[model samples]
Target: MAHAPAPKAATAAPVISRMLVHASEFRLNPSRRVVPAGVLIIQVKNIGQDDHDLAVRAANGHILKVTPTLHSGDLGTLRLKLKPGRYWLVCTIPGHEGHGMVRSFTVKKPVKKPARRR
Candidate 1:
């Protein structure tokens, strides 16, 4: 009789990275920014005493909605896979955006090849 080989073990998938953005005073701290092109994890913390939302718009007029509404002291998270491009981040709470609660940012593509040797 012949002996059997051992079975291989399965591996778990890696977790997607995230970016934290706090919502307060109708503004986002570190307003202007950039992220790597891939899965994006948005952590929204509503510090105001009212409901707020995290709305995003792409350069091509496409809308990528994050949190619809978050109550005071509440937290909302959105996981989205995005491509490299410019996007607008805003809190669509009445005159929030108009009150300087909106900001623009970009998603840069990760560098592929390393520098060539001399």
Candidate 2:
């Protein structure tokens, strides 16, 4: 008797990428200003002496993701899948953004690798 051909292994998607952001008195700083479109894990660290929270807003003024309020020395995380476009990181706390706690970033389409020659 002839046996059936073995099944080929399946390919899995890439692992989630990570980004770090620092929240201080009146500023929000990210480790990078540009990233590829995919699953993104944002980690926000409160390095100031007050309460702070982070919000991911789209260019159209819609809020996408947000992290819980973090106290001094506290850490919070926000996980999201972003499309290729412009986004802004801001502190939603009243008066915080007016103090300059906002920054812009860009997400680009991921690069595709050509298939290997058989």
Candidate 1 lDDT score relative to the true structure: 0.78
Query: CA lDDT, every prediction?
Result: 0.78, 0.94
Best-fitting candidate, scored by TM-score:
2
3-111 per-residue lDDT for model 2 (tens digits): 9999989976864678899999999999999888989899999999999999999999999999989999999999989999999999999999999999998988888
lDDT of 1 by residue, 1-118 (tens): 8779778788644335577778887787533388877787788888887678887778887778768688889888878878888888788788988987777878888656676999
**Which 10-residue window of candidate 2 scores lowest in summed lDDT?**
10-19
Per-prediction TM-score: 0.76, 0.87
After superposition, which runs of candidate 2 have C-alpha atoms over 4 Å from their true positions?
A: 1-12
Residue 40 of model 1: what lDDT? 78
